[model samples]
Target chain A: MSIIIDEKTKLAVSGLTGREGSFHGLRNKAYGTDLVAGVTPGKGGQDVEGTPVFDTIKEAVDEAGANTSMIFVPARFAAPAINEAIDSGVETVIAITEGIPVLDMLATYWKAKEAGVRLIGPNCPGVLSPGKANVGIIPDSFFDPGPIGVVSKSGTLTYQIGNELKQAGTGNSSIVGIGGDPIVGSDFIDILKLYEADPDTELIVMVGEIGGDAEERAAEFIAAEITKPVVAYIAGFTAPPGKQMGHAGAIISGSSGTAQAKKDALEAKGVRVGESPTETAAIAVETLRG
Target chain B: MDLLEYQGKQLFAKHGIAVPSGEVADNVDDAIAAAERIGYPCAIKAQVLIGGRGKAGGVKIAKDVDEARQYASDIIGMDITGPHGEGPFRVDSVWIEGGSDIAEEYYASIILDRGEKKLLAMVSAQGGMDIEAVASANPADLTKVHIDPTKPFDAAAARSIVESAGLAEDALDEAADVLAKLAEVAREEDATLIEVNPLIVTADRNVVALDAKVTIDGNSLFRHEDLAEIADTVDDPQEQMAKEKGLTYVKLDGNVGILANGAGLCMSTLDVVAQAGGAPANFLDAGGGSKAEAIVNALEVIKSDSKVTAILFNIFGGITRCDEIAKGIVTASGQIDLDLPLVVRLDGTNFEEGLAILAEANLPNLHQEKTMLDAARRVVELAGGAS
Candidate 1:
């Protein structure tokens, strides 16, 4: 039992004909995911890695019953692609493309929320439901099906933590990459809600970096409502003030996005704080064992 | 990228926004000519990127051409200390504008409220005052109009915002019209931010854009020729070098240098190093699938930094391929005479293969961590962290 995806989850690629879409589609198909169809405007009637392609998300969803979409469209086309996916009624949309203008994302995010669609990322590594069905760019060979769930703002950090968890003989219910964009579709709280509800998820590992009030907001939500034992690591401790450190959102502008602030907020809520991604998995294992 | 007042005004003029007739000059001769062209009673503004020029004596009202030259000479080549360190602050250029008596100063901005899916246009009657002061004290003075791209900028909504800004009947309509036009400009220019510090209402009963500053989205620059031409390449030396090498590098003034593949792990590397009581000097993310040359380029940028006391290599390979990173790391170690310690944390696809390369190279001060923790702790210790 995974948090956001499972074997039965129907999937499609929004930019099926693009390099990343084709690459991931083939890999996902090989991994036994139900890659029923794909959406590439003007590229209908084609097939990628044995998955049928349609020009629009609606056509693909209608013909192939795709319930989830992994968008590989370019930045300029990302908003519209996500909009099309939302309108097509895909319950879960994973956006793999990065660098979508903040304004475009603001508009698209609202439209998705209005349509009742859950978006994992517009610049994320996507979500993996362990040994069952993986929808993101994470290497499936590293994951093993188990009880711990992981949520992270950065994609490769998720992999690093997951690797440590696998080494510690702890598997995951699911690992969701919420993305590092300043204006991401889903955030810490949304994924935390899913992790909390999953019966298989016993312990959770949250990896967050600087920038924005998402971590602070998530800490507030965790302290007041969440009952699951959570082990967290807030990255960007050394990040300098004023200069935005690469990731669209990673900046130590004020008190809210600093590592100390996040650590203090989470610790006050009784969540164990790990010194690093590897330590995060270690702490999660210890917490779950306790 | 932050633009100076002179640059901002130039952009405003280009956008067809009404601004006081102005000219920018770099020296006293240029300043005298500029003042003469604009006539007497002009405003000579310093072209420093930092704000609050008026209070800092960076801005002065010149009653005549002689005063303009005096102000220009005082400002040009003058060093003003910032909250940070001081540099040879060039007057760069001085903006000489036709002076006008302002009836009221106001503030307006078009910004992306990411948390809220809207293009927020915020207006305040209290402008010339620092925005921070306004936000902290008279928060209510700021009125916001959320523009939905799906819908046109509503004049009725604009008027309501204008009224909320406490504008009088004579100025309300003009202010509202300017607000709508500014919003249009913001959208049309693909601007991430557009700030008019003092949207002025002149004594002549006219609304004028006194100052304009804008930040265009870098990702959308492929669509804008003018913006691309104006890209400020004067960034951190390391970043500038990295940009030349086709690698993404963000310079942070810290002692420990972090070179990693994938944005996620790069962030984690930063986190762990900090957790261990060390500061990462920069964020150099060599995207997944980077080759040895790319890795070498990233390392060069970090190693060139005199402040970098240690280097932390955190790579969790997927499509990036750990083997490629390892080869790159080895190549980098051989190419550069790194004075500091090197700590590596590598995992995933061909992890053992990558480790073998590093182990075989056996570079001096190069340490390997089986896990991210060991790498971070080792780097912290190497960085001279007491803890």
Candidate 2:
């Protein structure tokens, strides 16, 4: 069984009438995901790429049997869309919209937690369960069902690291791109817990970068609880201190959020921190093979 | 982006946070005049974006017009270097504000906590000093509380945090009020960090924010038009150009010009180059779905750094088509004449198509690598990184 979503998962995409929403919404269907419904306030009863649209998330859930939600709403409307998904009783919500305000995310996160909803991202490429299911925008073409579980803090890095693993003949159980914002729904530990519990995932590859203490905290959790062999790669080792590299979350403030600090933390927990993506994949492949 | 002190104060004032009456002046005469209007015994502060202005002799208390003129003259052209060598921050303007009798100083801030995934409200009764210094010396002096991510920011929580920090009974209510309002500013203004280093309890029993440090989140700028208007100010030429082109570009000190599709990958690309024994010239994210024009624009920016001996394009196409990036590279090759070598590595959807497009062009000095490591090694070698 895959984590997050699977073949039985039914999806309702909010903002399905918009440009990026329609584009990736169609792509999700083409990948054979159970794209059952769409949500657009004024454009209800319309269709995007043959998916039936509803005026609200509640309607999408009630009428179309949608159990999962993918929100492609713009940043300005993202918080409300996330709230709608949680309130509508969807078990899992993935926010694909980038540029959401941290404060807005905070409010939505509290509501989601109270409702016992699993929220993936507000600035991420969502989740891909290899051939079984695809949610959000992580390209399914790069994935194949296997034993490795891939989780990353950045979307492009997920693709990059996923490609490296695939080339090494190790397919993934599931892949989660957790987004590149200062505040996001899920962190490293959240996915790590899911991967640790999954029978299909024999090993894990955690891709993190400079910024935040998520990776450091993950390392601590991994040491205490995770029995699976995990390899990690953190970006921005050469990045200067006290500057934002690219991602809103990828920054080094003082001595706290440096790549070196993260690498050291992971290493202290018996996790191999690769100097490069290629090296990280090699370690995972080696560990599995041995 | 980090706002200047005066700009931060303006934002504070806009949010109903009490600040001393002040005006920014670009010249000594204007500073003196502004000080005269604000009343005597005022503070003349350099409007440098970098911190440590007080330590750099960029700040002085002036009791009269002569002192204001003298302080303004000394501060206007002062060069301040912040810790970790951030500056040589040149002072171009000065803020002359009415002075206050500080009965007590407190520190307060609201910021997004990455690890907790919540808004953090931190307050300390020990103020009139750098928070970092306070953190190192007496960590217990700073009281931090978390605000819920899925609910409106809790002013009550901030108030309690400030109250617990052990303020004088007379100053407690106003200090708590200031902390609460600061949390609101963090919510309403879409700020990543709002810091008041010296939230003063004045001699006359008034709570006034004597210093403000605000960092508005660039990602949330679209919703807050007012914050958007105050962003960046086009301080650096390349930065302004990148802003217009929608590229995430940060100039750095190195020679291997690097470009990648996403932020994480972009940063990883820089690290990989360094690992391969080469320094990156700049951090450039071509962004998702980047076309030929975007590549050309990025190349132009990289070209401005003459230290760049080679370039590397690390694209892992998801929503971003590799073939589009290939065409972009080809188009860029034709439009811009580059003497330096470039190594392109493409993977994911349409990767073969992307490779075919690049092979068709076979531009001069262009190399293709099958793996990221090979690509990095190739560019670094060409960059004179190989031993």
Candidate 3:
């Protein structure tokens, strides 16, 4: 079985009437995800191409049997949307909005934890279980059902590796984008645990970048708990200290979060860290073959 | 954004935290005048974002009018290099504050703990030194408490932290009060970091913040309009230009210019370029909307950098269509006086249509590669040798 999402997952779109929401929500529906409902506070009873739209997540859950939520609300309203999903009894909430405040995320994260709900992202591409369900914004064309489980902080980097794996005649069991913010709902360990538990996931590909101790911490967790062979790609090896390299969480602060330190940590744990995306894909393929 | 010392103090005072009275002066005369108004034996501190101002002689104590004038003049135009050798940032202003007689020095700060998903409050008796150094050298001297944002942070909680940090008994109550107020500033002002490096207990046993290092959350600045006004401006011309164009760009020291559709992709592109024996000049994320105009703007920003000899476009079309990116590249080539060789690698989501658009245009300076690795190597080769 796939991790996090599968054919039985029923989805609801949180900001289904908006531009990005409608665009990606409809696309996910077209890709055969069980996109059963939509939530847009004042736009209740409106239909997004036959998917029932409700005023709240509770209505979507009650009326349309939505088990999961894909939130495309604006940054300011994104956290509240996640909380509403948790309160409404949705099992999982995937936030695709960017620029969410860290404080708001902290509160939402605690709430989700207490409620036993899985939260995916605040500034991420979301999760894709190939040929089964497409929950967030990961491009549907780059994936297929296979042995590798992909977990990354970068959306495009995830897609790049997915494409590389597909071109090499391999595929992904699930591709989870945990987001690029300083405070996200899920971290590397959270997804790694799921991948390791999934029967279909034979190998794991982790794409990490600079900033934060998440990668270093994940290294320790992998060394202790993970028995699956993990191939990783960490960006920003040549990045200068103190400069925020695109992503909010991708910065080499002082000497702590340098790419070299992350690479070293992962390598010490027996995880093969690639210098580039293509090379990482090759290493994963080789590991699977071996 | 990191606030200047005076700005941090102002934010602290607004939140009921005690800070020494200070005035910000952009000129030497105003600094001297402010020092006189505040009384003698005032501290004239350089108002630059970087640290180590005191070590660079950017900080001085003035007892008399003559000394105030001399110190202000010395600091006003001083070029202090950043601790990381980043810059010789010129000090444009001085913060003159009334001096206080210190009884003891301690440290207190509130920062986001990503791992724990809580607001981390650290209090240490070993103050007036780098907190990292303190944590590394004497780990027990620093006491860290994680506060759940969902829960209330009260005076008793602050007092417990202060007491646990091993501050002197006399300074405990006042220090606790300061810590409580500091936490308020962190929560209310959306500050990612609120650090009082030397939270001092004065000779009269009053706790006051001697130095304030506050960094407001950039994402939350929309709610804090006043704080947004004081946000730091980009110093590099290329960075400022990229900001104006609404592109996520970071200026790096290299020759091959790199542009891509997402932050991760841009960073990975930089890594790939480096692996291919080329140094990336900058990291530019054109983002999801890689329209023709956005492409022109991104190309202009990358081309403006003199070090860039070649440009690489690594686009993995997810939400962004490769055809749109191709149109952008073709349109950008025509819009600007294109001189550098551009290696375009387009994949996924209508990539063939995108490649066809570029091939139909057949721009002489443009080259196409099917794979990211091939494209990176091609651009690096054209940009001379690797770093």
Best-first order by DockQ? 3, 2, 1
On residues B1-387, what C-alpha lDDT tens digit does candidate 1 reach at each position? Answer: 556666666666676667898888878899989889888788888877555667678888899877887899988776554433323255567888999889989898887665565688999989987887788887888887778767788556688888977877798888888777777776777776788989998999888888877766666676777667666455467777887887778877678888887776787777677767787788889887778889888888888887888888888888788889889988877788766898887888888999999888888888888877678789888977432
Candidate 3 C-alpha lDDT tens digits along A96-131: 999888888888898899999999988999999999
Q: Model 2: runs farther than 4 Å from truth?
A: B27-29, B63-74, B77-79, B85-88, B148-159, B384-387
Worst 10 residues of 3 chain A by lDDT: A245-254
Model 3 vs. true fold: TM: 0.96
Model 2: how far residue B85 lies from native, Å? 4.2
Evaluated on chain B only, candidate 3 has a TM-score of 0.92
Model 2, span A1-290: residue lDDT tens = 67998998899999888898888888888888999999999888798867899999999999999999999998788889999899998999999998887777877777887899999988899999988889888888877789999899889888887887888887999999888788888888989999999999999999988888999999999999999999999998888766777778887766788888999999999999888888888899999999
Interface CA RMSD of each prediction in angstroms = 2.5, 1.6, 1.2
Pairs in steric clash, model 2 = A106-B149, A106-B150, A107-B149, A107-B150, A107-B151, A108-B150, A110-B150
Decoy 1 TM-score against native: 0.91
- Please, what is the whole-model Cα lDDT of each candidate in the order they appear? 0.80, 0.86, 0.90
Residue A58, candidate 2: alpha-carbon lDDT = 95
Residue B287 error, candidate 1, Å: 1.8
Candidate 3 off by > 4 Å:
B84-88, B385-387
Worst 10 residues of 2 chain B by lDDT: B149-158
> What digit string (tens of lDDT, one per residue) describes model 3 on residues B1-387?
788899999998888888899899999889988988999899999998777788899989999999999999999988998676756778999999998899899999998887788889999999987778889988999999998676688888899999999999989988888988888988898887888989999999899999998878788988998887785366689988988898888888889998999998888888888888999999899997578788999999999999999999999998889999999888887789888999999998899999999999999999999889999999999999644
